[model samples]
Target: MLLQTAPAPGAWERLLAVLKEWDFAVFLKINTVWTGAFGDFLMPILRDQRTWYPLYAFLFIYVIYKFRWKALPFIIIAGLTVVLTDQVSSTFFKNYFGRVRPCNEEALRGMARLLLDRCPSSGSFTSSHAVNHFGLATFIYITLKPYFGKWGLLFFFWAAFICYAQVYVGVHYPGDVSCGAVLGVLLGGFTAWIFKKYFNFGNRKRGDLTTASPTV
Candidate 1:
């Protein structure tokens, strides 16, 4: 008798294929259909690393000034979070999936609008920009929420805007950003939990917060 494959596996494959089609359709909607002059001008700027250098510098100094030596551990962990997410998304997921970017996709040869002068030659899935920003956003939101309260929520929006820019510029699909966001959140949350449990800055209230050693 011939061996038979399970029907569930076939169904799962069909479901994945349908989801991929939807992902592509949504990507086109964002990248091509839903667009504006202001967005076209601003998105590339929003996604540019150089644009955020001042902000990054400010945050680095602010944290050290705010927490003194205690901020050192937090800084190290935050840096590690970005490094981990970038490697996982760019090195692992992108290589494993090997999906071509919309700008490079043969199917979108004439349909896609590529804003960049030249598209990146890397794989498309799980955008590293999305992963890194979301990871940092989640880490910042979690670690600093106690001090910043509702204002910390803006970090998520900041990350999301960067992710949108990635799709708008035709470098990544919606699914890529979505999955990257989820993965980033997971890794960030885990690191945050570790920091809180072990390398906690202090237990002092936000108002009464003062210098404290990095200890549990």
Candidate 2:
């Protein structure tokens, strides 16, 4: 009888190793520095709940009103999917993996980096910011695809920017953000598909009729 084995790390680790090599280190450092400069300006905007919360709230409400009751289920499901992805990536996967944040690692100890202060002993295998932002953006994109036509590409760029910002801030490794992004895309799309199938928001069946016509 053959024994079962866990799957290999796949392309992500291979890519990370390439990035970590001495030859690539200089390139990574330069890119990181440039990204960090931009991140210094963008992180505050991305990280601020005050800014995003109102924006998301307004968008959600507007979507529901614009699309009518049919949009409510999608909005609610997308919101829940975003929260769930964030919690799972941050609380479960991070704690279970217990990976060290890139900012706190020995390699970065003496380097001057731009970012908010490092998190206090938090696990860092997968970035919550990357996961949540990508997940929510992806879900919204999927839900609104029919409405947006070819413009759905814009949402994809939005998700990618947020994922890149995570690494730029020095809080997450590129590998971490990459994994989070992949997972976020899968989960977001899957959740939208499931909601569309089961929610029955637009379909009204004959069985839904409450009363029959009089026989007079």
Candidate 3:
């Protein structure tokens, strides 16, 4: 029998390995040290999309009620924003990186606490939840800011909250969510700019939604 020795990693590869270790350390800190009974119960709920069905419905209804026919294009663009973010993050980034979820890692079987019933088989470089939510948040903030003022900022906090819950629930690393957020923001902002440029929804002064608005 012949024994073969593998080549050692180069500096760049070694650096990436070190970064990965640091990411795992951060994941462990969030998953283990920052946990509690209340978090264990609430994070899963917060991170779950099912929990926000009512909010989604309300937003759909509210946009139509406020903007009438003009809401159609906004809705379409918003939906596309989420789809783009989800696909780019989940399909492209995940497949490219192929990083394992902490919960799904055999090495972390005893260490990582998985709050969900089953851990997904997808790769974990960029969190789809973070991408989707942050994309939507960015779209909402930019498109609706003229009407909602500073309240639009709340959308970002909402996105961050869900991303934090994702880490707390043990599915994604902090780096995954952080990069997802940046990508989401870029995509969402681009879509919003497109909508504003072509669709031309009434850009009333900040917080002034009472005036008769122009339709797209």
Candidate number of the best lDDT: 3
Q: Can you write out model 2's per-residue Cα lDDT over 1-216, one digit (the tens) per residue?
A: 999998887799877677656423542463365664566787656654455677578767766665566666777798789888988897898999997776677666666253665444788778777677777777777766555546866766766666666566666666777778888888787787777677623432356432222111
Give per-residue CA lDDT, model 3, range 18-134, as digits (tens): 988898899999999998999999999999899888977888898788888888999999999989999999889999999899988887889998889989999998999988998
Ranking by lDDT: 3, 1, 2
The models' CA-based lDDT, in order, is 0.85, 0.67, 0.89
lDDT of 1 by residue, 146-179 (tens): 6666898888898899999989988889998999
TM-score of model number 3: 0.91
TM-score of 2: 0.74
Better of 1 and 3 by lDDT: 3
Model 3: worst 10 consecutive residues (lDDT sum): 206-215
List ranges where model 3 is wrong by over 4 Å. 1-9, 205-207
Stretches of candidate 2 exceeding 4 Å from the true structure: 1-32, 35-39, 47-50, 112-114, 200-216
